[model samples]
Target: MNDITPADSAERRRRVARAIQRRMVAHVAAGGTTDFASGPLENDPAAYTDPARAELERREIFLKVPLVAGLSRAVPRPGDSLLFEEFGQSIVIVRGRDGVLRAFLNMCTHRGTKLVRAGADGTCERRGRMTCPFHAWTFELDGSLVGVPGRQGFEGIDMSRRNLIQVPVAEWNGIVFVRAAAGSDELDIPAYLGAFAPELAQLELADAAPIRSSSLAADCNWKCALDTYGEGYHFATLHASTIGVSHYGNVAVFDDFGPHWRINFPDRRVKALVGLPESEWPEADYGGVHFLFPNTVVVVGSGGPGGAFVRMFRIFPGQTPGTMSCRIEVYALRGVRADGDRAGEFAQDDAESDVTREDYRVAVDGYANLVSAPAGFTVVYGRNELALQSLHRHIARAIGVPL
Candidate 1:
């Protein structure tokens, strides 16, 4: 983990502010518009409808790649724990009493019963000691099987050899990452982030706590739901009644950070920073949307009159190719108390859900149409949707398939 001091945090914010100012200036100089890609990109329709390819992705990408299991705040205390089911694998992320975080299969070492079960929305509270409900088997937070009922029946059984299976886990910039498959190499979060590390570190996510989380089932592929967020092209037409009123249409700054990408969409408020000095410009005047490689999208914006907030979207493949699950987590700066904070948080949550529902509605319709589309059908991603193009390319490369 990188030790980021106050000076480092301030410097990162200043750097981002300067970069945005430069882009704004260049946009004005070039006739008040953002740049565009050379041409549109095309993707095969089967990439979203193929069951065989989805299974391969489940093994190669979902299992092998480091996925954002949850935020650091999900297990803030030493005894805090949570269960995550991704790609059909049950994972338990826990913070041990030694102040270390670890991941393991959420199963009893004796007889393989699930150690814990998530609530309706796939979330649960911390458990100091995990006990399998099926049998009287108990285990510690660090996946050490300490007690087993009916031990006399299993004579000469080595307890040390029967510890719960451990999965590779790491925390970076307040995000928890896990690799579910056994014997997989440790996921180096920093190395994987590459040049984006410094920028992501600037978000100061560790200084925030998750305020609310909710999930919705979508009648579309996981990628289809994710594609809705990779571009702002639909804001004017699809979101005209909601976000489109406050945000500009089809105007954004795009940049690549390794396999990840970021799209900065300036709201009507961004015009206020046009002539201001770089030092005086607000750090988060624009909506900063970051697409973490593979599955997560982090959207950062101002929290009303004070503080800041972030909304993270994690999309996972469902039981079939035509279904997907989307989880949204909203977080705010820790220790920042103000009047009507709860009201403000609830308002934000409602507003986000309203806009997200619109996106999903369109995506679901698109998916249904694609399933019945004629042969040789292909989806075209306009130049304005470069992020989608890049994301599809990475997915194809990971699954060894052609887009």
Candidate 2:
């Protein structure tokens, strides 16, 4: 195979989009046919309820690996900063004056106080330096300690030792990744992504811009909430009035790249291609539901009344199995849409509504049964629910657990 290069990336995207479109079109023509596994997979319910398992996942999957912080556009400028908080830990990611991306503990060396606060717009705006709210200790954008209010009080201490504590950070294909645990290994994005790097590069996310966002706390295992995104099997019932009205139910095309995968369920609109020539087939706005291993769901699709948008959900484990927090951010590719575009707004709003109001409500109620159910109880993923089944398999391998 020839090496994938930047020049051919756009062509690759066109090819990927067309291939997915063909798969979706064919499935729709076949009356909602979808890929299926050879047999049903019985997954342990305790995987979601076991405190030990949850903690193990927290360390093995989330903390041990790099976590998606935000888009590179978040801190585009030299002095720009972003505060990333998850699992009770906060990290400050910034670009130095020299244009290098850097991340550090969001702490003041003097007293461990948070160093920066977001402005009214929810972005870290600073001059050339950051000042701690507690002791007024100042640090440069690159995390260098630049000043101390009480210099004479600590004259004997080495100023260099008092700089902000740095953490692991890397930028790739427009995504910003950071490791909250200082003891974790340094980031090697290419090795971390493996074959998925070329696929991500094709998206050209480096130029995508956020249009709108929302965050929510839910009562359920993070995996449970995540499983909801893996299939359209529930669209006909759970989302009958929302997503079901547009997308076909129980129809999807699944492609796996290592632990990462993309699943696409045809929308009713694709039926237009049923009798049309391949040359007349319309391009797919929503390429597919893309899952970046561990925890992030990214889908590039239409916003309904809004237009083209990229919707992302970053799910984080709460302190226990019964709790999880989610952050949803919708972005628009440059020139494809504008800031304050209703398409992006509607997409984010409708998505947040569908996930929180509908799916999460069911998860909350059903999880109760899971907690009280008998020890032999197991959750079954039918042959048709391959995406969800695959997710469980990936999680098992990542955390060294047998599913």
Candidate 1 residue pairs in clash (backbone atoms < 3 Å): none
lDDT of 1 at 65: 80
Q: Kindly provide the TM-score of model 1 when superposed on the true structure, using C-alpha atoms.
A: 0.93
Cα displacement (Å) at residue 259, model 1: 1.2
> Which ten contiguous residues of candidate 1 have the minimum total lDDT?
24-33
Q: How close to the true structure is residue 339 of candidate 1, measured as C-alpha lDDT?
A: 58
lDDT of 1 at 218: 89
Positional deviation of 31 in candidate 1, in angstroms?
A: 5.7
What TM-score, computed on C-alpha atoms, does each candidate reach?
Answer: 0.93, 0.93
lDDT of 1 at 297: 93
Worst 10 residues of 2 by lDDT: 334-343
Name the candidate that leads on TM-score. Answer: 1
Which lDDT tens digits does candidate 2 get at residues 332-394? 754345445764567556755665578888877777789888989999998888888888998
The residue pairs in collision within model 2 are 306-343
Question: Taking the tens digit of each residue's C-alpha lDDT, what string does model 1 give over 41-84?
Answer: 89877889889988978887888888888888788898788777
